[model samples]
Target: MPVAECGRPASPLIVVLSGPGGAGKGTIARMLVEADGSLRLSRSWTSRERRADDPDDAYVFVDRAAFEVRRADDGFIEWNLFLGCYYGTPVPDPADDRVLLLEIDVAGGRQVLDRHADALCVFVDAPSDAELYRRLVGRGDGADRAA
Candidate 1:
């Protein structure tokens, strides 16, 4: 992948947002994506147990067998076992000019950076850990606070 003048990938720019569980990475990613039309959020596939209040749009919830099938077929660009469940970013299709935002863990972020050297890696950090925890707890609705 070729790096653009702005330090992002040329055609299919992979933007990775990652941080601690309580960090504001997801919030920032959502804000940037909602404010911009060019950015597209890659929905993740997960084999984890879903919460009662889990957002329907958060992930494409699948059973263990289905997740294993995708994993065996290498359908994911990057996948990791976190909190006893599997999470992965689907392989992205070629885009003429579009920024793909991936909200994943640090491990997955490193994987994207390694696979696509030109990809831009953004680490969203809160002012303090306490503040992050507060924000996580204070999220009104549709926030994945359980990790």
Candidate 2:
């Protein structure tokens, strides 16, 4: 039975990492998850075309219809469309006391904060505009617009 149904106390940790498009939030998240055994990364679903250098398992690439269906089924805890592409986080069911890390954008981060007051919210970014631009360019994600 589920912990809630069993009346067992299991307070899982949810970490929501958010920042601007060219920010280093993803990099930070990756590093944390890699270094911590108790932290699990919640891979989000996206309808956007994958980036050239994106890893094979960076995201669950789905079409619009599939994404909408998941939304209708309440699969995603938070979701939004940015830059004409849909991005959503699937409801994570981590083991008891484990930390679930979510690397998301500003809008989706707000949605998560509204639902989860206990979540640890972390905003990550480069040291300066030049650094941010340099990171984005290096990652093959050009600036979405003029800074």
Candidate 3:
């Protein structure tokens, strides 16, 4: 292991940002990583289709079968099934020295905490319920799902 400025062994800081959909978790995570070169946002893999407005690097889009195969192979550090879609975070490389940022949901946060007790978890929320619903619907989620 590498030593820090104080000479103690260095380890990556796992930071988890979790919240309901349309709560701006992704936006916050992106800003944090862009502002700090040492913070790396781990790209999540999803079985859901990528939205048209989603950035090219938003996620590692994959088919359900491929996602299932990866899950069976223990490729994910945390995984969840939401609204008929599978979402998971791949295990970060052990050699990576940068801090890791995970944008996930409540259930995934629990799983990460179970494995990494030292992780810092932040819960993000929208300014209001109305705003959250509006954001969700604007992002193409059905009204029922947004509600």
Candidate 4:
């Protein structure tokens, strides 16, 4: 029997793993997907170049032009700009059986929650402000904002 949500059979759950930059959402999401056969991580699209330490598959790296084209074409379910870079999640295939796992910026995560009321969200918080700042600087991703 299918699980019922809001009086209807629940679709595969969208699990949003959100956090501030360098808070390790990607790491946690990867671990979850590796451990759970039922989860499939959705790689978000971004105009920003991948960091040296970032895994090659962290995001669907694209130029600004391509990102804008997709955004204008209504390809993303939710999108946001952070530190002057565009990041967005694509529309998922309805036939997919594995639950979607997303590691995204906080703003975009909020948008997802608003759009999908049934989404299950988990915020990966930094242990401390100082530690978060260190991680940001170490990643060379402009930690000045966090400072």
Largest TM-score belongs to which candidate? 3
Candidate 1: residue 46 lDDT (0-100): 96
Better of 1 and 2 by lDDT: 2
lDDT of 3 by residue, 16-64 (tens): 9999999999999998887777789999999998899989999999999
User: In candidate 4, where is summed lDDT lowest over 10 consecutive residues?
Assistant: 1-10
**lDDT pick, better of 2 and 3:** 3
On lDDT, the candidate that comes out on top is 3
Model 3 stretches astray by more than 4 angstroms: 1-9
Compared with the true structure, model 3 gives a TM-score of 0.92
Task: List the global CA lDDT of all models.
Answer: 0.79, 0.81, 0.90, 0.83
Instruction: Rank the models by TM-score, top first.
Output: 3, 4, 2, 1
* RMSD after Cα superposition, model 4: 3.3
Residue-level lDDT tens digits of model 1 in 5-119 = 3454346788899877557777787888887777888899999877665688889999888998999999998998876789999998785366888998899989888888877
Candidate 3 lDDT for residue 66 = 98
> If scored against the real structure, what TM-score would every candidate get?
0.80, 0.85, 0.92, 0.88
Error of 1 at 60 (Å): 0.9
Error of 4 at 33 (Å): 0.5
lDDT of 2 by residue, 24-94 (tens): 77778888877777777889999999988889988999999999999999999899988788999998774
In terms of lDDT, which candidate is stronger, 2 or 4? 4
Off by over 4 Å in 4: 1-9, 143-146
lDDT of 1 at 67: 90
